[model samples]
Target chain A: MSMERAIGFVVGIVAAAVLALIARKIVARRGGATGEYDERQQVVRGRAFTLAYAVIMVYLAVWMVLRNVELPFFNHPSSVLVGILLSVTVFVGYSVFNDAYFRTSDRPGTYIALIGAVGLLNLILGIRHWVRETTLEGRLLDNANLMVAAMMIAVMACVVIKLALDRRSEAN
Target chain B: MKNLKLKSARAGRDMSQQQLADAVGVSRQTINAIEKGDYNPTIRLCLAICKALGKTLDELFWPEEP
Candidate 1:
């Protein structure tokens, strides 16, 4: 992996650890000893994961076909990142909508903030790359990081919309 | 298509869905799904709900003969 990817991976792990710490604090503040992921949540998550697995399988199959046909994106080796990001978006979005990921005791705002933080970080980076590519003759625009950011933003929007709709429905 | 009996039992006890869900250690959405017949709880959860509402498994979960 490139140094950028290596750093990104380490950052991802650190972010996950930080998220766990935050969740622990939330659980403690709520006085819920169980700390989320109850039996029902697990069942929902299982079903969501099954669906996400099917999605990834289909995506990989399409990638294989495109590779055979010598498509531009698949012709390059790094296109696999696209497949992985798609699968991740589907998995996260599915779990978020199904209420399988975040604990009910945890505030929805917390997750929204988390997604917003990541999305904002990516957006800033992607925009900087875009500006460089457009003006000062930098590297190409077909960046995996930017593509991943776009996909994350799309998925985050969907999850947020779904959360709002569910809240409205519950109110009704 | 809900198991109205469970709903009635819960209401009869003056318990809201959220109250029952909290008592049984689940989200309100899960309890709503169970009552609406959109989702089935595991045997363990069924027992938990039964105990929370002071009902037997059959009283809360068994299918009634038409």
Candidate 2:
């Protein structure tokens, strides 16, 4: 297909992979031998996820309806990608909102902000793609790919550094 | 947010979040949140915190002195 769409697909895949790694770590940490996630945390997470799922489904329905309508600036793939990004973002938002409200925790806000930033970045990328009908091999898509890759690497690096520091302190 | 004298005392004793959580039978995240003033401990948890830090309730959670 178009270069922009191809770039979006690649970015989406990379984002999915990064999110998977983060989720795996969260699950492992939560299920570790020592002081794992309590029943209350699980209950809160379950409720939040349920609400997220509902919001995602509703977003999908709305997206489908909007796709049929002739929108001037919005196209098929961009709209679809935006819908998917927003769906996942809604989940992240739900998690942070629930954590802040019910658990009185502030840590989840960081995760929420990160997700929101990524969503906004993707939305910008989508709009840029629509304007510059470039091929995946073109400069625009290549730059976008590089930017996303850099962000993923940065996130992974930060996590690794934090874990290393934690371990080092524990040993001392 | 109220100051966490218990956490401050525990830290003064060179105890980590995990150590304090273990002593109080709670998660490390809970200890971290409490120390950061992002959580309000229950009465039972407050007692546990006081016990862990080797302090009385009044010392750890004093009223606003006039």
Model 2 stretches with alpha carbons more than 4 Å out: A1-35, A38-65, A68-172
Q: Report how far off residue A168 is in candidate 2 (Å).
A: 13
For model 2, what share of native contacts is present? Answer: 0.00
Every model's Cα RMSD, please?
3.4, 9.9
By summed lDDT, the worst window of 10 consecutive residues in model 1 chain A runs over A135-144
Which candidate ranks first by lDDT, i.e. highest?
Answer: 1
Q: Cα deviation of A73 in candidate 2 (Å)?
A: 13
Tens digits of per-residue lDDT for model 2, A48-141: 6777677768877876676578553233444444445455445544443333222322233344345445646655775575467666534333
Model 2 residue B24 CA deviation in Å: 2.4
Model 1 Cα RMSD, Å? 3.4
The fnat scores of all predictions, in order, read 0.40, 0.00
Which window of 10 residues has the lowest lDDT sum in candidate 2 chain A? A98-107
